[model samples]
Target: MPRKRYAEDLSVEELRLLLIEKQRARRQKRLEHFRRSGRLVVVDDHPTQPPLETLASRPLSEETPPATANPKHTRLDRLLLAIEILAVLGLAFVLLNGFTLIRDLNREVVAMINQPTLTPTPAITAIVLPGGHTPPNSPGGPRPNDAEIPEHLRPVMLSLPELPTPTPSVEQAIRIQIPAIKVDAPVVQGDGWEQLKKGVGQRLGTPNPGQRGNIVLSAHNDIFGEIFRDLDKLKPGDQVILYSNQRAYVYIVQQTQIVEPTRVEVMAPTQEPIVTLISCYPYMVDNQRIVVTARLQE
Candidate 1:
């Protein structure tokens, strides 16, 4: 048998003649098939045959139906789309974490400033002289019993003179002077973001000047004036002078450390009067905190 040719390969005249012959042959075959099966076929009395010119007049539409997409390519495209969505979500999560970290750091600073101060009642001190004269709370009076004196009170009674803790009605921190680090900024009674914007903030609930407890003063290292920018330069024996209550309370730097922000122990109370200065670590990137601890000079 000869190889069959498609409509695209046939001329207009040939295609037209071929279709007419094929239609007649199809009718004859249908008639013979129905007779063999003994089935009566109903034929139209006036069969309206379509015009043969239509075959050559209008070429078969070249616009074929679209082919189905490949399953492998479709699956690969879907996987790529899923990966892109996941990447976008991951980027959003990281940005959210960064924002949260900055916000929480600011909130922590503000909370430290707004915290209420807990005032301790003045301790009663009754001392007896050599002549059995009981003086009313005289710090200068000679203490008799060395064994009876509390460890905290021993230094004040024997060597260092008693320095009274300042009791200001309102929270007021005048000035902070760290000559070693070249820091001489006005002090404010807050560690809040807004307060720190003005100057260094003194944390509430800490000891006052000359008091026998930890005095925490914290400020920003990179932003909001960067008051404690050179705080890391401070070392042992460096003097940190805080002028308040018309008196200068000098503190000798004992040690400096870089600690996590969650380390609240750095701000805990102490038996002896001390000063703790805190700032964000690593210069511009504030991921950790730098703490400088100092004790009051006698």
Candidate 2:
């Protein structure tokens, strides 16, 4: 065989012609071999690649693959989308249930804790003498001798008109203002979540402001506008004003304390007119309570 020529020995035009000739010969040989073996079903005499126009015009359904996506792939995409939606809904459902359960548990714990620790203070009916002293035993003092009172005044007292019983109003708290902490918020009736969410809440059955017993009020420290968020900042002698039925009742802070949530003695009744404010301890945690007690400033 003659000596083979290396690609580096050929000029640019010569190298191009040589490659074209080699490719043409290879194609011719392949066609003849396939023909002689009776394996060729179609033949093309083109010496170069088919034109773009010819390829584009060919029937895609028969000669080329379909352009539309596979049916199985489409179904898989739809399934994946549905699963993602389901996952999001499930997560939301779980979160809602968790919040409800937590609220219910908290309410239960509060009910159990506040199971009437001390007896309510009894109403006082006393007759004070001019010297400001009470005589004999408590609750049933002896009747003074008739010489002490004029005979004419005693008959007048016996014939005194019976005063009508005042009707109790169903109004809830209207407003609250704490001067020291600069808190002014509307007050709601119940200590439930809905009421607290609006503002401060007054526990049902607790004495109203200016009343003789304890006036129990509570709010969240970290939520519901954080009306009592700065409760711990208050010192004794601060003033809190609660408005009800268009009347304002002022209270002077007496003490502040932190106790476990189970300690319900803070809500007990007292003979003196007082107000109690309760909030969760440490800002965001409900592990303890911050109790702030104030007495009505007559």
lDDT of each: 0.70, 0.71
| Cα RMSDs, all models | 22.9, 25.2
Candidate 2 local lDDT, 1-298, one digit each (tens): 9889999989876665565567657977998899889998665465577654454455545444669888999999999999999999999999999999999999999999998797656332111111111122324542222333346666654564433322356444578999899999987776655667788877666767777988878877665577888999999999989888858999999999987554666777678989898876676444466889999997
Clashing pairs in 1: none
Q: How close is candidate 2 to the true structure, as a TM-score?
A: 0.44
lDDT of 1 by residue, 1-298 (tens): 9998988999977876787668668977987798679895557745676566654464544324568899999999999999999999999999999999999999999999899987665332211101111121336532222443346755554553333444564334588999987888887675645566678777656667888888888877665566787888988999999887568888999999987654656776678999899887667455567889999999
Worst 10 residues of 1 by lDDT: 126-135
Q: In candidate 1, how many Å is residue 29 off? A: 99
Off by over 4 Å in 1: 1-172
